[model samples]
Target: MKVAPLPDDEAQRLAALRGYGVLDSEPEADFDELTRFASELCGTPIALVSLVDAGRQWFKSRVGLDAAETPRDVAFCAHAILQRGVFEVEDASADPRFADNPLVAAAPSIRFYAGAPLVNADGFPLGTLCVIDRVPRSLDALQRHGLEVLGRQVIAQLELRRKLADLARARDQALAGVRAKDVFLATMGHELRTPLGGILGLSELLLEGPAGGQDGVADDLRAIQRAGSHLLEVVEDILGLAQLELDQPRLRPRRFDLDELLADVEATVRPLLRGRAVALNVGRSPTPVEADPTRVRQIVYNLVANAIRFTERGSVDVTVAREGDTLAVRVRDTGVGIPREKLALLFRDFSQVHGDHEAELRGTGLGLAISRRYARLMGGDIVAESEPGRGSTFTLTLPLAPAT
Candidate 1:
């Protein structure tokens, strides 16, 4: 419905109403409860805390009303909002302006109407708190005052909801920004690793062959190659994470035996378990899953690596199993568990849980982040559970393709 241009004061009020940012949001229980009580107190079949926008009147709360919004031109509350005080019509049938209105002509034919204008935080009249009835009735002075007080309450609720929404949006934006930075770091790491790997590979070949003469020189060269290779691995992990953040990374999916993959991940991380008095257990059912083999390896590697890194005196357990069309893998460690506050940041790039740079524990803080990215790339998810001073477990869940 086309509403006539609002007058100067009405326009200002309508702008103020929209500024609250409460229109078209989900129904809130706090305002709904207030309106429900008001409806009961006034003994009206229909009651609403309606907010007037440019072309419509929306109910923040409603009782005994099917419609959530109605055209402003045909709204009884629209006319009611023009005054600062109470607006009442004894009977719509007696008023020419509303005589032919659909609410008056149809079922639940509105006859009695009483509305109190709602004002914004700045005291600008914006909309109404109204009660409607089929039978013409008059409200006592106390009821009128109560409705006005309830209208003020509704306004307060709207303002609070608006503030909450604003805060939530800000939080989301901040997270997005952090995710972007992670992507950048990951990309640079990848680019640096590719070249570093080549340099390390060449250095190793030289140290092993006739190019190295003295034993001491050979040891020095081998150390350089090993250190470079480790750094290169770190760089690659960071780059992979960055690409994953932009959602631009592609995985090379292939059919693979789940049991074999689990065995390989176990073998790779076994060296970390030596002399720690910790046992490593691996369990995998003979399940085949279609996924990127390389990416899956990275996923398993990260989880197991993290388990070993955090657990100093206890065993790390790995499990892989399939249920129906889904594959599940879990890595459990008995070590110093992550704190509740730090658990959420585990998958965030460069978000290190350990604050002190102790010699025994060293990490780049990209393991979990990269693991999560690879899992998601292969249509899977990773979740964690941890309790401080006890242990932590990371679970990876993935979908399996059906047999041909």
Candidate 2:
């Protein structure tokens, strides 16, 4: 039960090991594949990518071995990293340092051991890429160097993993900030809608009464009414989006005809077209699928309305079809196309098309987000494909039946 002595720079070594944040992490294919390669290349039954920490050696990947970890006192890797080159034990049973070792006397019966220390660019040895066998063995120059090269590759993979994790953390933090802002806006919109509702009521009363006969007063009140209505829509979008974010929606699925749903979406969006040349063409798919018909209409309405809002004089085409066991509803529109740089931001709240923060065609900015959320809750998703200066196509795909 003798423990291995710590390096002189034990504090720095431990810091580097911890910096990777890899100590008890799950096995990844990159590391597993490399170890499998080592086992074959070195002609050994067992291969491991071991990370030596303060009290134990953790195997990030193991091939042909059942153990996940071993005490540092019994880790051959603890001695391997002390050398600049490969450490070899042709016959561990004959060496004083390992003969009495339980690993040698017990199962796994380590008679041969060779390990190449995994060192980072900072010259700190974190662990070893080791191979073990039950019989006395040796490796030629090429096999030894192969282990070293594989060890370096393991370090490279670890560094890549650390970087990718850091990027994921940064992205999650940014998303959290956006969510906080949306929550605030939703709360504020709830508060503002009450006052705006009163304004609309008063304006209507003024237009219907003496203000209607007051000539110019009636015209000005109409403008106020329209503005109030627009603001009210924005506030509603905010409230819906906030509710979706704050709760896991429970979908109520029922049997319904797909064409019947599309009919309503077409009729609702026609008036919003306002005599524009955007023809709303919806294909007939008489598929009797069972789903939440209400949410389906909501998704269709949001997409069609969005298309009608963006296109000034072109046609908006809507199609529905049954692709195998799945249903797809695609909305294609000829409008000012979204740029490649802004495509990723399409479903995010508060993002506008063509990089315009104040585009006249912009809605509450929560329309697409809320629509996508509803679609996903029904076990479906919306995908967009567009080219700049051409047109954009948004496709919604869902299972034919309720997804269990």
Candidate 3:
């Protein structure tokens, strides 16, 4: 008996076969059905969907065969894979190469064999869909054609399985990257806040000392205070965003009055309007809500502060009222209205829409992003409407009930 030699492109063919990840896999119904069909069409007692591994021929699907695999040296399918078309041995017992082969002389007593090479899209023959008969016989033209068609189907199934696995791996990798980014942001935010708090506290104390009355000295200290305060705000926004992304935002909910919360937010942002010609007008009616007051306050403050920064000489209006089962808080600014195209960037992290006054109104661009996250976390959302020169309105809508 003659042993089948390896293909000319043995390494590449093996690599291509391994890529499918089908070797030694459990029998699948799709492949089993095809093997059964091949056996019936060829009038063979034994049929197989065989994959040739480095040292063995593993049967992915088999009919009338008890063993799962056979050594490659004695595998009839091994020789078949080297051929482009069907390889047929009319009488294996009479053929010199397989007459003395163990498969022909042993238990199954194979006397006839026909196999269609399973060739992939890249033209690598991975294995075969083959049939065996104990009695000497040959498959007609139609039977040979049917066997080749089934072989192509096997290759198609393998290709599909590989593609699905690739997509799953890609999705997992993208999710891992997002988690890593969140962790890094959370760590760095905490690290920077310690020093920033000290700077702001020291600057405040210096400004209250004898330097408070010094003209140039007081101005310098105030500048330091302002920069420190802005940096601290940015760090806080980063921490908030990272916490939300990590899905660990611990919200403490309680029953609170929406009108009173708005009042406090108004007072907090009124100081920011000291130099600008913006008038802060807040309209409210008594409204109760069940949610985290701290998060709600932060969202409202962000919206009001954002409006004041953009409006150079216009009115910023804050209004709150109940609409059915939800409460709506609208912050409308007469500042340079956002361009229609830039509206979508308002709530995306690190994304900013620049206008004529963007230089003076520059920010970390995380305020709106963080606000929207908090609103949604508590069963609410924020939306914007604007006309280019007429100003913009950001409305925060929240359900009156606590979030589940």
Candidate 4:
């Protein structure tokens, strides 16, 4: 009998299987106990947790067998992964596939075989929990059930590994973000200090020289003050982003008019829309909402900022309306709309929708994520809808409070 060629992706699967670093590593008694129980329940002479690699089957745990591995070309685990469930062969001697197989006719001379596919967390079959016996015997219904149960335990092990991998990735991403923040901090410090030094030096010169009496000196001082204010706002945003990442307390509830608050937001963002062929349309309403004032302002600012940022040549409309007991504020922009696939990741930290606008835009990618956290803290939520190449709308909804 000729051994069939492995799949085209079999090599990739083998590489990933070995990447787990479990194969050929030191054995733990936890896995050995599992294999021992499987063999005892099946009444088989050998039980092995076999990981099918490209050219070999590596045993995670082996019982009643001295050898650690065998060629995958003759591995039963290879066949087991081809199916979703267990693969059973009561008599390999009669089957054409294993009639002249070296493992069957040579060393093991195995006639009975039972294998339950071990699937990973992502539901990809990696290998098998199998039992081999020289004497041909079929498993009863109860024995088959037992093998299936053991397969779940093997899957649990793989799931644990997957969780560990995910945790490692998250930790790495967080570390990288911290490093970026450090660099930003250094740059901000230099920028801020240079301007502050200039302002201080200019003020001293003006106070001591003839420029102190000149009207232009006052204008220069005002410009210096405005620049300092803008720098402070940037610094505050960085601090707030850091606090939100650390999950610091957010709720500081206060009574505020939803209409007035929204009007203020419109006034603030309208200037950003000027010269872009974008107009601001604010919808008025008589609704009052109870929420954290600072957080609410942040949500409004970030939403409006995001709207203006994406809209190159279209209008950004802000609407505040009362629906049932909820107050909804919508910020809509006709810009480079987000892709449907990426909308799910919009609120995820550090996930920026990379596109044509990416080259012209500079952001820390933490705004939406922070806004969502703040919204949740105030017992409200933010939702988004976007059509690719058309536009996007972001809505923040909060529970409306009765007039007091």
Candidate 5:
């Protein structure tokens, strides 16, 4: 018996076949359907979608067959894969290469065989779509063409399977990376907060001590306090963002007067308007809300502070109203308005919209992003409407009751 020799690109062909990840897999209906069609079209009792491996040719799908695989040395599909087109033996018993082969002499007793090479996109033949008969016979031209067409479909399925697996792996990797980043941020934020708090405390004590009567020493100490305070604010923003991203912020909901909450927020940010010509006007009715007052206060404070930062000489207005089951808080600023194109970027982490005139007021840029996250966590959202020179208005809407 003559054993079939390997193809010229045997190493690459084996690599390509393995890359599909089809070896030794259980039968799937898609492949089984094609195998059945091949058997029916070729008028054969046995058909298989075979994949060639290093030592064996495994059947991915088979019809009228009990064994899942055969040795490569005795596999007709192995020899068939060396050709770009179908390889046929009118009678395997008469062909020197397969006449003495165990597969032909015993068991299934193959006498006739025809196979179409399963070629991949890169022109490497992985295996074959084959049909076997117990009696000597030959397939007509039409049957041969059908078999080749089905072989291409098998390659298509393999490509699709590989692509889907690749996409799933990428998705998992991206999620893992995001989780790692959140962990790193949370860790660093905690580590840096301790020293920053110490620096601010020491600077304040020095400013109120004997240094207060000194010439330029007090100013330097005050500057140190300001820088430390700003750094502390940045650290806090980072910590807040990390917590929100990790889904760790627990809302403490209670029934409270939203007007009083707005009043408190107004008082908190009024100090920010001390030196600026911007007018802070808060208009709200006596409305009661059942939600976390602290978080609500944070969101409103962020919006008001953001408006104040942008408006140089105009006014920042805050208004509140109840709409059905939701409450809307709008902060409008008469500063240099954000461009329409830049509006969508307002709520993205580390993203800030900067106009030519507002460049000097650049901040940590986490306020809006964190605020929106907080809003959504409570079943709400924040939206913006603005015209470049006419100024911008930001509206924060939340459910009146905490979402169950």
Candidate 6:
């Protein structure tokens, strides 16, 4: 018996087959179903969707068969893939090439064989869809056509699966990139806080020391202290925002008097307003609301602090009220107004909007973002309304009661 020779484009065909990345893959229901259906249609006891590897012909889908693969030199499917159309042998024992083949001489003896090459779009035969019958017989015209159609279907399935796998890989990579960015920001917060603490500590110690009127030393130390203090706050804000971004922030919610909360915030902010031309207006909010008190306080504090930072000579007003089913806390500032176009960026992390001189206001730009998140975690949201010259108003709206 003579062994079947390789195709003229053997190297190209093998490369094209390997490019599919489907060899030794787990069996799929679609391919298996097609194989079983083909077996029934062709009146054969065995059917397979086979892939021709470099050293073996692997069965991707099989019916009425036990062996998963066979040596390429002895595989009838290997010879079938080399043909352009259906390759049929009425009787394998009468064919010189397969008569002495172990597959025909031993178990799963192939007497009547018919296969259609599974050709890819690139015109490479990667494998075949074949049927085998133990008795010597020939396939009818309709059966041969049906087998070839099923072979093309197998190629279509393989191509579709490859595309889906590529998309899944891309999605995983994008998610990984976002995780790495968040982790990097968190790590930098800790790294920045160390130097900021050292600078703040050293500057405070120097300021408290008795000076020899050392030229610019006193003024320099004061500037350092202010910068260090701002940097420390920014670092803390970064750390806090990172925590909120990466995980959920815990809320210790409780029932509290809205007016008393505003009073406490007024006392804390009044000391900062002492020497400034700005006025702190706390409208009467004699209403009680049920919510997380600490998170609510944090949200209000951040807004008030932000207003104070931007307003140089105008009043900063705070008002709280329960309107229907919602609680509204509005912070209005008469400092520098926000631009209409930059309003969309007000709550974005690491975003600062000071108009053309936006660069002058410095701190961790994470305050608004963190505040918004804190509000939402308690089932609320913050919105801003501003005109370029009329100043800005930030409103924090929350549900009056938690969802049951």
lDDT of each: 0.80, 0.84, 0.87, 0.79, 0.85, 0.83
Better of 2 and 4 by lDDT: 2
| lDDT of candidate 4 over 219-247, digit per residue (tens) | 57645644544454455556667666654
Off by more than 4 A, model 4: 1-31, 82-86, 89-101, 104-111, 119-125, 134-136, 215-219, 222-404
Q: How close is candidate 1 to the true structure, as a TM-score?
A: 0.50
Tens-place lDDT per residue, model 3, 1-404, is 99999998999999999998888787789889999999999989999999998899999999999999999999998899888899999999999999999889997899999999999999999999999999999988899999999999988888888898899999899889878987788678768988898987787788779987798998888778768777777877877776776675889877777878888988877656755888899998666777799999999888898888788898999988788888999999998888899999999998889854466576788989999988888888999999887899999987776444
Structural similarity to truth (TM-score) of each candidate = 0.50, 0.52, 0.79, 0.50, 0.75, 0.80
Identify the runs in model 2 with alpha carbons over 4 angstroms from their true place: 203-404
**Winning candidate number (lDDT):** 3
Q: 21 in model 4: Cα distance from truth in Å? A: 7.8
lDDT of 1 by residue, 291-353 (tens): 888788888887887787678887899887776678988899998888999889999887778
Clashing pairs in 1: 183-242, 186-238, 186-239
Ranking by lDDT: 3, 5, 2, 6, 1, 4
Model 6 error, position 34 (Å): 1.0
Q: List runs of model 1 lying over 4 Å from the truth.
A: 1-5, 9-26, 91-102, 105-107, 207-404
- Specify the poorest-scoring 10-residue window by lDDT in model 3: 354-363
- State the weakest 10-residue window (summed lDDT) of model 2: 352-361
Residue range 143-242, candidate 5, lDDT tens digits: 9999999999988988998898799989899889878988788689878988888887787678668986796997787667657756776787877887
lDDT of 6 by residue, 229-333 (tens): 667667778778767766676787676667777877777665346336998898866455667887787778778877887788989999877777888999999
